[model samples]
Target: MRTNLDFSPLFRSSIGFDRMLNALEAASRTEMVDNWPSYDIVKTTEDDYRIAMDVAGFSPDELTITQEQNMLLVSGQKTNGEEVHYLHRGIASRSFQRRFELADHVKIVGAGLANGLLTVDLKREIPEEMKPREIEIKTNIALPKAESRQIEAEKAA
Candidate 1:
């Protein structure tokens, strides 16, 4: 028996968008994707961001955070505790993995674990040219402000 794969549809589609190409490239990196421990991405500021995850029952030693290219990965493992007898068990302390796709120029500021929440801070430093700046408009009226102010307030004050 012979199995066949088709690429006719993909080849027939229009190819002009850079974003679409990037998406295809990212799809090839499925191994980098992580879906564990539940997480939330919050936008703190226009150029600042934070990631909070519920990493309960995981110690700092078992957790590892690293940045690969423009990706943030967080992995943790549950260490084996001392032998004991349990009549009933309900809590989950299994290992987990989480991944975050970061934007250009986005850098991790720091990370902290408090209570049962693990928070990671990220900041993007925009260039001076890219930042919003007020442009000065030049005009032909070169009169002094002192005289112009008195004339404009003749009837007001």
Candidate 2:
């Protein structure tokens, strides 16, 4: 059974969070039927992350990684080779595409393929202006006694 979530209340109260809410709603509605080429996401540090995927039969040239705005796309396409018949085929070498939603400043650092595993590194680099900063509070200086006396004399007059 699939349940639909209503984000109308959040929409009414939240500001500048439309994209996040929309993503959540879309994720809830999507049915992930294909889970081939298993992958894992791990956070190495406070701002570093890694995505490792098991692409056993895919070569470096057969895989593609692209980043656009807040979206990361990874795809693989096997090249046509000599056809070989197998009595019991088990390994999967089909084409597949995977997508990941990245945060505001998350960037792809590097990627490597080894031992049939594709590893992608990511780091979150917050801009200087966007980083948290401390503000210095200024206190008002006290008025001079002569100025206070002049104001009192003028009021008396």
Candidate 3:
């Protein structure tokens, strides 16, 4: 006999099972994506990041970079002629499109394919309005409006 388990409470909190499930689903989907193109994302600084991918057989002319709907998409297709292959094959050369979900205000700086590795640099620009700045207050003033106004008037008279 199986007993019914209530999962209603899991959805009631902020970091609930829903968020976990979403993260899990995203991770699983990304894992199952075209594995021929593997990538690494690293945070280099406070607001800087780098995404490097292994693209051994791909050339700079075969790759494309685009940003659509806040997603940074990197795709590659090798037009370099295909050889009717041998008894064994290791390097993969076809076509692939890899997408990364970008956070708000995160932008792609540029991309380059070098030495068989494609590097895509990213920068998160926090607007001056968003970054916190120190605000100072002068609370030791002697003038309290009414008295200061009377003193100004007396001086004027």
Report every candidate's CA lDDT.
0.79, 0.94, 0.80
lDDT of 2 by residue, 15-111 (tens): 9999999898988885867788899999999999999999998999999999999999999999999998889978899999999999999999999
- Please estimate how well model 1 matches the true structure, expressed as its whole-model Cα lDDT: 0.79
Q: Write the per-residue lDDT of candidate 3 for residues 18-73, one digit (tens) a residue.
A: 74555445555424545668889999999999999999988888989999856888
Candidate 1 error regions (>4 Å): 1-20, 24-35, 132-157
Q: What stretches of model 3 exceed 4 Å from their correct place?
A: 1-33, 80-85, 142-157
Candidate closer to the true structure by lDDT (higher is better), 2 or 3: 2
Distance from true location, Cα of 103 in model 2, Å: 1.0
TM-score of each: 0.64, 0.83, 0.68
Top model number, TM-score: 2
Query: Where is the poorest 10-residue window by lDDT in model 3?
Result: 148-157
Ranking 1 against 3 by lDDT, winner: 3
For residues 82-107, write the lDDT of model 1, one tens digit per residue: 98797986556778777777776799
Sort by lDDT, best first. Answer: 2, 3, 1
In candidate 1, which residue pairs get closer than 3 Å at backbone N, Cα or C atoms, i.e. clash?
A: none
- Best of the candidates, lDDT: 2
